[model samples]
Target: MVWEYEVRYQCLRERDKAYTNWLNRIPHKQYALAFDGGYRWGHMTTNLVECINSVLKGARNLSITALVKLHASQLASGNIQVSCFDRQNEVFKVREMPSGLEFAVDLRGLRCDCVEFQVDRIPYRHVFACCASQQLDWQVYVHDVYKMDQVRQVYRARFRSLGNPTTWPAYNGPWFVPNSYLTRVTKGRPKMTRLLNEMDTRMLRRPRHCRLCGVEGHSHNRCRQSAGANADRDAQ
Candidate 1:
């Protein structure tokens, strides 16, 4: 049953420490939906999947037809194969077709043995069948998060562009120099052990300016004018 994300993680950690340790190397925000902080807005994968969809637009109809056929088959399964037994008015024992596996659905609690209800907080065919048999309002089981007002707000504001890089202000930020000693051999032909990358050897940042004169080439302490000024001030 769709356990809480953190609960599931804790269980995994307890079950296998090695797997969890391997997982710990990667950032949580990159992999876990719970840690994403609503950035995806229910979109699991955007760019890569969207790129694939755009490339496969011509052959998309075949997949669509297959999905429709699968949906129709599932619809039949809901209607003919599934039967529910009510326990008072809150709990239900649903017996499936063929396999005859039983699932307990708690109406008041908004939970089902099949995790579809708990994950999306939306009623699926099983929950609908259960509600239908009892003549209970299934809409009451729907979470408020799915309301039109909330859904509309997700796309209400348009995304603004970052604008031209040329128009951007001169960066006075700290330079992040990569440690040559720490760098492992990446993709490329390996050379002499003594040789490092030419790019790494060079200072890739803007030239330093003197603090006193704000002129490039030398630091404030080393500036001739700054030293002369200090000497003159000392003589005075």
Candidate 2:
């Protein structure tokens, strides 16, 4: 409950900030807002599992094939219904438009032209249909998908089962190497001697300038004159 309150407060604060930012330019008395937690806010905390459960309420007694067939039918019918709405709405908005682009999405009527929403009536799919048709980038509309309280419940349960990381088991494998065996090693050959030689040749070909001044050998980042108090030490 405390976490839910915190989340609600944060949402309210964010909305308040956005309102303030936009209203700064206009006069204060332009409009009045009712403090009902910012339009559809209460619904943000509820889980849609109840809706899904309602749809499958009688499925507990059904056979496996029946259940699978029912769900598949539901999903298909829902998606297609929503797509239909998307097509129609897009057509209405633009007269003589191509049939492929116009989607009929009627939110006010709770009728998504797509089959998904028409069959299943899932709100998220309606939003998805609308986003897809309108190119609104629906991933950013996350509040429609997850509830804060549910997220809190998950975190609480995880911590209760796993405890904290500070008490985790220490490494149990062998950790030491033999020191005497290291002395017998020879200096390894360079993997790309020719490449190193070419790089050196390029450097030599460059005009000799103070590497510190980008004047041939140096860059401003390493310039000696810019060394100020360290100039004498640099010269030495």
TM-score of each: 0.34, 0.22
| Clash number for candidate 2 | 40
Tell me how many clashing residue pairs each candidate has.
0, 40
Global Cα lDDT for candidate 2 = 0.52
lDDT of 2 by residue, 95-205 (tens): 111223334555535454454445554456546656666666555444432657667776675344666888889889999877986686567654542212221445447
RMSD of each: 25.1, 25.4
lDDT comparing candidate 1 with the true structure: 0.72
Highest TM-score model number: 1
Predicted candidate 1 versus true structure: per-residue lDDT over 125-192, tens digit per residue: 77887878878888999898989988999899999888999998999999999999998978766663
- State, as a TM-score between 0 and 1, how close model 1 is to the true structure: 0.34
Indicate which candidate wins on lDDT. 1
lDDT of 2 at 26: 64
Off by over 4 Å in 2: 1-52, 81-130, 137-236
